[model samples]
Target: MKTIWITGASSGLGAEISKQAQSKGYRIVKLARSFSTSKMENQNIISVHMDLLDENQVMKTVKYLSEQGLAPDVVINNAGIGIFKTAWDINQQEAEQIFRVNVLGMMALTGAVIPIMKEKQSGHIIQIGSQAGKLATAKASVYAASKHAVIGYSNAIRLELKPFGIAVSTVNPGPIATPFLKQADPSGSYENSIKKWLLDPTKVAERVVRLIETPKREVNLPWWMNVAAKAHAVAPHLFESIAGPFLTKK
Candidate 1:
C-alpha cells in the first residue's frame, strides 16, 4: 500500500484530498494547524496538528512518523497563504509573515521529510505552488515571489534528490475557491471576477493525490492557466499594461 503525508489537511484542498485519498486505499497522514474531529475520523488516516512555521514541531512530527515505521512514500507540502495587496500596501512585517507561512514554513517541513525519504532511497515530494509563481503583478508581488521560490526550490531539488530515489514535483494552481479567499480578497471591484476564475480546492487536491501516486515531474491543473502564465512571461510588459490597473487599487 502507498502512504503519503499531506500537509494543509485542515480544510479546503487539503481536507478534500485526505478523504479522497482514503477512498482510493492510500493510507494518509494529514497535517494542519486547525483540525476538526468531524473531518478526519478514518482508520486509514493519521492526523498530525502542526504549525508549519514552527520548525521544531515539524521536525518532531516527521521523526515520530519515522520511528513508527510509517515514513511516507510521498510528502505533499500544501499548506499556504496569500495576501493580495500592492507590495507596499501590506507593509514589511506583513510581507515577512507571508514569506514565513508560504515559503520558510513549507521549506522547514520539507527539510524534515527529505532526509528520511533519502534514507529509504525512494519517495516523492510534491510542493503545491501557484500560477502566481509563474507571473508577477502589482498586488501579488510578495505572493508571486514566494511561489516563484517554490518553483526554484522544487526544480533544483528534483535532480538533486533524484540520486536518492526521491522525486520533487510542484503543482501550479491558478485560483481555488476556499475559505482562504475570504482572507485574500482585495476588497476591489474585481472580487467577483477573481472568484469566478478559481478552480475547486477538492479538484486541486485530487490532482495532487493522483500526480504523487504516479511518477511525474510536475502537473499544472485546470490547464488553461498555462496560457495566462506564459502570456505574462513572453510579454510581461504588455500583460502588465493590461493587468496593472484592475489589479491595483486606485
Candidate 2:
C-alpha cells in the first residue's frame, strides 16, 4: 500500500480526499489542528495535531515523523485559508496572516519532506490551488495573490524536482464551495453570481485523487475557467472592461 500524507484533513476538500484515499487502500496520515480520522481510523491512519503557523511545532512533527521512517510516497499540501477583502480594506496584519497559512506554512512542510524523497528519488508533491491563482479578481485581492503565488511556486518546483524523479503538481479548482467563501470577506461583499457557481468539495476531492494517481504536471477543473484566465491574461483591458465592474461591489 502506498503511504500518503495529507494536510487539512479535518474538513472540506481535505477531509473528503482523506476519506476517498482511505477507501482506495492507501495508508494515510491525516494532519489537522483539532480533528481526527478516528472514526474510520486505524493503523493505516495516523492523525496528527499540527499548527502550520508554529515553526517549532511544525519542524518537530516533521522530524519525529522522519525519525519513525514514515516517509510518504506522496504529500498533499491542501491546508489553506482564504480571506476575501478589497485590497485597501485589508490591513497589513490580515495579509500576513493569509500568507502565513496559505503560502509559508505549505513551504515549511514541503522543505521538511523534500530531502527524504530526494534520497529515494521518488515522491509527489500535490498542491491544491484555485482558479484565482490564474487570474486576479476584486474583493478577493489578497486571497488571489496568495493562490497566484502557489501556481508560480508549483511550476518552479516541478522544474527543479523533475530531474530527481519527484513529481510536482497542482489542481486549480474554480469557485469551490468550501468554508473559504463564507469566511472570505466576512462582510458579505462578494458578488452573488460567483457564489452561485460554487462546486462541491467532494467533486474537487475526486479530481485530486485523479491527479495523485496519474501525476499530471498541473490540472485545472472547469474547462471554461482556464479559457477565461487566458482571456484575462492576453486581453486584460477587455477582461477588466467586462469583469471589473461586477467584481467590485460596495
Candidate 3:
C-alpha cells in the first residue's frame, strides 16, 4: 500500500484528507503538533509529533519514518497559519510567524523528504496553496505573499524533480468553511460576507486525495474563482477596478 504523509492532520482539510485517503486503502502518517500529546498508531495509520516551526523536530520525524520503513510515497504540505489584517495593521511577529509556518516550515519538510524521494526516484509532493496567492486582495498582504512563495517554490521544484520521476502538485482553493477561517478572521466579517461561496472542506479534501492517482501541476477549487484569478492575472488593474469592492470584503 502507498504511504501518505499529511501535515496538520489534527483538524480541518488535513484531517478530512487523511480520512478519505485511508478509506481508499492507503497507509497514513499524520504529522501535527497536536499529535505530540496523543498516541494514534494503528496498522493503517501512524501519528507523529511535528511542529513545522521547529526544523529540528521535522528532521527527527522524517528520520523516525525512514528508520521505521515508513518513508511516504507522497507528502502533503498542508500545515499553515494565517492572520488576516491590513498591511499596516499586522505586526512584525504576526507577519514573521505566517511566513515561517506557511513557507519556510513547508520548505524545510519538503527539503528533508526530497533526498529520500530522489533515492527512490518516485514520490509526490502536494502543497496546499491559496487563491489569494494568484489574485491578491485587501487585508491579506502577508498571507497572500506567503502563499505566492509556496506556488513559486512549487513551480521551480516541479521542473527540477521531473527528470527524477518525482511529481509536484499544488492545490489552490478560495475561502473554505474550516476552522482556518475562524482563526484567520476572528471578527467573522470575511466569513459572513463570503458565506454563500465558501468551498466545502470535504469536497476540497476529495480533490486533494484524487490528485495522488492523477497528478496535476495545479488544481484550483470552485471553477468560478479560478476563472477570476486567471482574469486578474491577465489584467490586474482592470480586474481590480472592476472588483475592487468585492475584493475588499476580506
Candidate 4:
C-alpha cells in the first residue's frame, strides 16, 4: 500500500483527507501540532507531532520520518493560516506570522521531502493554495500574498522536479467551510456573504486523493470561480470595481 504524509492532519481539510484516504486503504502519516495516536484508532493511521511554524521541530520530525525509510508516495503541504484584513489594518507582526506558516513553513516541509522523493524519482507533492492567490481581494491582502507565493513556488518547483520524475500540483479552492476561515473571519460576515460558494471539505479531500494518481498541474474548484478568476486576470480593474465592495468589508 502507498503511504501518504500530510501536514495539518489534525483538523479541517487535513483531517478529512486523512480519514478518507485511510478508508481508501492507503497508509496515512498524519502530522499536526496536537495530533495524538491515542485519539486515532485506525490501524492505517500514524500520528506525528508537527508544528509547521517551528523550524527546529519541523527539521526533527523530518529527520525522524526520513530515518523510518517509509518514503511516502505523496506529500501534501496543507498547513496554512489566513488573516482577513485590509492591507493597512494588518499589522506587521500579523502579516509576518501569516507568511511564516503559509509560505515559509510550507516550503520547509516540501524541502524536507524533495530529497527523498528525488532519490525515489517517483512521488507527488500537492500544495493547497487559494483563489485569492490569483485574484486579489480587499480584506485578504496578506493571505492573498502568501498564497501567491505558494502558487509561484509550486509552479517553479514543478518544472525543476520534472526531470526527477516527481510531480508537483496545486489545488486552488474558493471559500471552504473550514476552521481556518472561521478564525480568519470571526464575525462570520465573510462566511455569510459567500455562503453560496462555500465548499464541503470531504469533497475536496476526495479530489486530493484522486489527484494523487491523476496528477494535474493545477486545479481551481467550482468552475464559476475559475471563470471569475480568469476574467479578473483579463480585466482586473473592472472585476475589482465590481466585486470590491463585498470582498473589502470585514
Candidate 5:
C-alpha cells in the first residue's frame, strides 16, 4: 500500500480526506495539532501533533519520517487559516499570521519533503488552495493573497519537479461548509450567506483521492466559480461592479 502524509488532518477537508484515503487502503500519517487516532481501527494510521507555525518541529517531524523510511508517496499540504476582513480592516498581525500558516508553512514542509522525494525520483505534492487564489474579492484580501502565493508556488515547482518524475497539483475549491467558515467569520453571517452553495467535504475528498491515483496539474471545483474567475480576469471592473455586493456582505 502506498503511504500518504497529510497536514491539517485534524478536521474539515483534511479529516475527510484522511478517512477516505485509509478506506482506499493507503497507509496514512496524519499531521495536525488536534489529530487523534484512538477511534481508527487501521494499524496503518499514524497521527502526529504538528503546528505549522513552528518551523523547527515541522522540519524535525519530516526529517524523522524520511530517515525512518516512512516517507510518504504523497504529501498533501492542506493546512491553512483565513481571516475575513477588508484590506483596511485587517490588522498587520492578522495578515502576517495568515501568510505564515497558509504560505510560509506550506513551503517549509514542502521543502523538507522535496529532497527525499527527489532522491527517490517519485512522489506527489498536493496543495489545497482556494478559488480566492485565482480571483480577488472584497473581504478576503489577506486570505486571497496567501492562496495566490500558493498557486504561483505550486505552478513553478510543478515545472521544476516534472523532470524528477514528481507530480505537483493544486485544488482550488469554492466555499466548503466546514469549521473554516466559523473560523473565518466568527459572527456566522458569512456562513449563513453561503451555506447553500458550500461543497461537501466528502466530495472534495473523493476528488483528492482521484488526484492521488491519477495526477493532474490543477483542479477547480464547482465549475461555475472557475467561470467567474475568468470573467473577473477579462473584465475586472465590470465583474466587480456586479459581483461586489453579493461577494462582500457587510
Candidate 6:
C-alpha cells in the first residue's frame, strides 16, 4: 500500500483529506501537534506528533517514519496558519509565525523527505497554496506573501525533481468553508462577506487526493478563480481597479 503523509490532519481540510484517502485503501500518516488516536479512530491511520515551527521535531518525525519503513509515497504539506490584517497592522511576531509555519517549516519537512524520495527514485509532494498567493488582496498581505512563497517553491522543485521521477503539485484554492477562516479572520467579517464563495472543504479535499493518482503541476479550485488569477497576471492594474471593492472584503 502507498503511504501518504499529511500535515495539519487534526481538522479542517487536512482531516477531510485523511478520511477520503484512507477510504481509498492508502496507509495514512497523519501529522499534527494535536493529533491523537481518539480523534483519528482508524487503525490504518498513524498519528505522529509534529510541531512544524520546530525544525528539530520535523527532523525527528521524518527519522521515525524512515526507521519504521514508512517512507511516504506522497507527502502533502497541508499545515498552515494565517492571520489577516493590513501590512501595517500585523505585528512582527504574527508575520514571522506565518512565514515559519507556512513557508520555512514546510520547506524543512519537504527537504527532509526529498532525499528519501530521491533514494526511491519516485515520490510526490503536494503543497496546499491559496488563490490569494496568485493575486494579493488587502488585509491579507502577510498571509498572501507566505502562500506566494509556497507557489514559487513548488514551481522550482517541480523542475528540479522531474529527472528523479518525483512529482510536485500545488493545490491553490480560494476561501474554503473551514475552521481556518474562523482563526484567520476572528472578527468573522471576511467569512460573512465571502460566504457564498467559500469552497467546500470536502470537495477541495477530494480534488487534492485525486492528485496522488494523476499528478499535475497545479490545481486551482473554483475554475473562475483560476481564470481571475490568470487575468490578474496579465493586467494587474486593470484587474485590481475593477475588483478593488471585492478584494477589500478581507
Cα shift from native, residue 63, model 1 (Å): 1.0
Q: How accurate locally, in lDDT, is each candidate?
A: 0.79, 0.83, 0.93, 0.86, 0.90, 0.93
**Per-residue accuracy of model 6 over 1-250 as CA lDDT, tens digit each:** 8999999998999999999999999999999989642233566778888999999989988998889888899999999999999999999999999999999999999999999999999999999999988988899999999999999999999999999999999999999998999899899999999999999999999999999999998999999989999999999999999988988998
Candidate 3, residue 103: the lDDT equals: 96
Better of 1 and 6 by TM-score: 6
Runs of candidate 1 exceeding 4 Å displacement: 36-40, 186-190, 242-250
Superior candidate under TM-score, 1 versus 5: 5
Q: Which pairs clash inside model 1?
A: none
> Backbone clashes in each candidate structure, one number apiece?
0, 1, 0, 0, 0, 0
RMSD list, candidates in order: 2.6, 2.2, 0.9, 1.7, 1.8, 1.5
Pairs that clash in candidate 2:
84-184
Pitting candidate 1 against candidate 2, the one with the higher TM-score is 2
lDDT of 4: 0.86
Instruction: Write the residue-wise lDDT of candidate 2 on 1-250 in tens digits.
Output: 7788899998788999999998898988888787532233687888888888987877987887777666888999999888776788889999998899889999999888888889999999999988889977777788889999888889998998999999998988887776666677566545255666668888889888877789998788788878888888899899889977644542
User: If scored against the real structure, what TM-score would every candidate get?
Assistant: 0.90, 0.93, 0.98, 0.95, 0.95, 0.97
Candidate maximizing TM-score = 3
Model 2 residue 120 lDDT score: 90
In the range 51-162, model 4's lDDT, one tens digit per residue, is 8889988888878877876567899998888889888888999999999999999898888889888988889999999888887788898999999999999989999999
Tens-digit lDDT string for candidate 3 (1-250): 9999999999999999999999999999998998864355779899888999899988998998899889989999999988889999999999999998999999999999999999999999999999988888899999999999999999999999999999999999999999999899999989999999999999999999999999999999888889999899899899999989989998
lDDT of 4 at 228: 87
